[model samples]
Target: MKHLFLFLLTLVAFPFSYAQQAPFQDEINQFKQQDEQHFPPKNAILFVGSSSFRMWNDVQSYFPGYTIINRGFGGSTLPDVIRYAPDIIFPYHPKQIVIYCGDNDLASSDTVTAKTVFERFKTLFTMIRQKQPNVSVVFVAIKPSPSREQLMPKMKQANILIQQFLKTKPHTAFADVFTPMLNDAGKPRKELFREDMLHMKPAGYAIWQKALQPYLLK
Candidate 1:
């Protein structure tokens, strides 16, 4: 009876613990501490989002002349980004903000739809605009990935919705990386992905660099 009771407690405790967990909280805190020691330049381009942006460690190298700061944390969703925006995004005073989330939100849960994802993004956009009215906002279109092929349909839809939304907002741009990342057969190109077929290779970042270059504030 004691063993069974313990097992029941474990099951009950697991859900609450997991629910309370804030993904990448430590990583975000580290960025703040680093900033206190030596602040990142003001009026630079700030990149914030999911693992895609987090893994793009050398983003500054792509745009040699521009001052850029990347605040991406792996496995973050739109809501997570919004939740931490005040601490992560506001302090930097970036002239432009580039984002790349939502893929995780879609993959992590089956219930989340493309429309819902877009709505969350709008919420984030609204918050940013309220604080930084003239800031240039760039949304990198979700790229098709071989590992997450099953989720691509929804991903594509989210990208389209976001891109269209950007069209209506002045000083906002969408980097349509979806088209260039696809093969003629309309599938995610395998070469662009790593062995995991998820994250990216240098070749993949190369494509992003090209797609986003024109949109970067001069």
Candidate 2:
């Protein structure tokens, strides 16, 4: 009877322990592996965020002169970025950081509001500032996506909050990729997105490249 009770307790704890594993651990590990093989140069401009930055695999080509280190992982939210900042942000010792996130935070749950995302981003910004006080930070606004149109109002609010916050900080800029991605009719440009309507096609990225160019640190 004692042995059976111990076995049952172990079974109950196993799933809970497994579920507690950090999200995106595999992706973060993969980045570590890549760094070991051929580490990126320090003081380069670092692009860190969600799928948008991750999917921009050839981002270096878009900006001819700048050396960019992209550390965007797919399906990531603000908290996830914060959780892995030691691995992704600080290690690179980037002179500048370009962030494109918060969209997934709003989409992740119905209970997650615009204010929630804004607060979360502020926390991330504060973390970066504390670690690298003078690094130039450019925030690429949460974009308008056709598939997630329902969350546009929240996205817009969060972008405004983050932009306002950055305005008060030195060496910070807000790139308004959100506005240019919209059509004259105030709708997302479907042509800019891939078939899934979440990720961008090259056309969409072209818009980003143009918006972000002026903000990049030489």
TM-score on alpha carbons, each prediction:
0.90, 0.93
Give the number of the best model, judged by TM-score. 2
Give per-residue CA lDDT, model 2, range 5-94, as digits (tens). 999999887867767879998899999999999999989999999999999999999999999999999799999999999999999999
Clashing pairs in 2: none
Best by lDDT: 2
Q: Could you tell me the lDDT of residue 6 within candidate 1?
A: 96
Candidate 1 residue lDDT tens string, 1-218: 99999989998878677667687788888998999999998999999999888999998899899998999997899999998998899988899999999888898889999998999999999999999999999999877899889999899899899989989999999998888989999999999988999899999999999999999997
Candidate-wise lDDT, in order: 0.92, 0.94
The 10-residue segment of model 2 with minimum total lDDT is: 12-21
Enumerate clash totals for all models, in the order shown.
0, 0
